[model samples]
Target: MLAYRMRHRIQFQRRVQTQDPNTGEIIVSWETVLFSGRLDVPAEVLTGPGRELIAADAQQAETTARINCRWFPVDRLELYTWRILWDGRIFNITSAETDRTARQEWRLRCSDGLTDGQ
Candidate 1:
């Protein structure tokens, strides 16, 4: 059996804004994100026509969207929505702020047994 090895890692960085209730000045915070995962391609999947390996450069360029003060404001009374970009689509993942600091393994593989046809 053979496995597709990941050639590189995915990374993200964020800037958050906090405000002084009294001064109304914005304070910025920076966060670094790191993700490691593999891409699984099944032999049963097709490699031509509708089924093809996704472009290597595009796949390697995949990175998580950055969440900033514009998305999550400090003065705002409500929580902001989180956004994620997969493939070429932009999606909203959550409507609440992630108020915790914890690291866990995040795995994402194409079970569809298809690549981007590149």
Candidate 2:
């Protein structure tokens, strides 16, 4: 892979659930940083009629992004539970894939949960 392609800086976060001792309430938090890396591939915004269809069916706008990182344990990632921060935008990890044999790179597919707004 071209190193120059990984120009966008991105951060991965995982949600953590904690209980308030006194209030007896469950707190949803995402303070855990699973990984901090660069995305060589730029993000692609979904638009036009296809985007409308996705919004109608999924109820949210989805943008696709590919993130590249060095080989790391795949267990560190939890699909659908991890969020990505890039350029002040938040994206949810839709899928992650890597070649077990190569074990040199990680490709992440992400979706920004919005239709028109970033």
Candidate 3:
């Protein structure tokens, strides 16, 4: 049997959203970057939060992207507040609410073209 060992001491999760700039439509391309301080590892993925934003027969106009990242502390042993980046803007979201739930899932949403309708 292979012994399982944690290669890195720390781990993190990052969620990102990409959208079209001109039409405000969601774009499926343009990979997002995610970093882990302790693990020194990075990964990228598509289809999150605003996945519904993508429509058939649609052409990307412009691009807007959002990223939500989280880091877990070794001592604290708890889910901490997360940071997010949206279209070159950075914001923070608290994990206070997560404590109340058994399982928590965070996501970043991107919407540029479609609106709620006036």
Candidate 4:
């Protein structure tokens, strides 16, 4: 995708646990990992009539974002622990793909959830 289409700012987060020193309680939170990235809507979302496409997409699943960011090494085993936040919506990291050939960028497939991350 062109850099211009990546106008949205996306943040990467991971689930983390911390101890409340005084209360001895375990605190769970989403910690920011990579600062932010340029984001873009996948082509499928823009292929048809605006209203009709949105209506059809809504029936299937929550919003999905294709986040494009400069290449970075990500531990594959920990993919499930990540989340992407953009425009105030927090998304579960459904999958992550790397551009091994060029090693110039990586994309993430994220889906918004209704539970805790919301």
How do the predictions measure up, each by TM-score? Answer: 0.23, 0.68, 0.21, 0.64
Better of 1 and 4 by lDDT: 4
Which run of 10 residues does model 2 get worst, by summed lDDT?
A: 41-50
Q: Rank the candidates by TM-score, best first.
A: 2, 4, 1, 3
Q: What are the clash counts of all predictions, listed in order?
A: 7, 3, 8, 0
Pick the TM-score winner: 2
- Deviation from native of the Cα of residue 37 in model 2, angstroms: 12
lDDT of 3 by residue, 1-117 (tens): 012321222123244358778999875432223343243322121223433334556743323333222322322222232333332333332322222342432223333334210
How well does candidate 1 score on lDDT at residue 77?
A: 21
Per-residue lDDT tens digits of candidate 4, residues 1-118?
4666655556667788899999999998876774334343322111112121334356433555566666656685586687766767676766767776747676666666434353
Candidate number that wins on TM-score, 1 or 2: 2
In candidate 1, where is summed lDDT lowest over 10 consecutive residues? 40-49
**Quality of model 1 by C-alpha lDDT:** 0.29
lDDT of candidates 1 onward, in order? 0.29, 0.59, 0.31, 0.59
- The order by descending lDDT is 4, 2, 3, 1
CA RMSD of all predictions: 14.7, 5.3, 13.0, 6.5
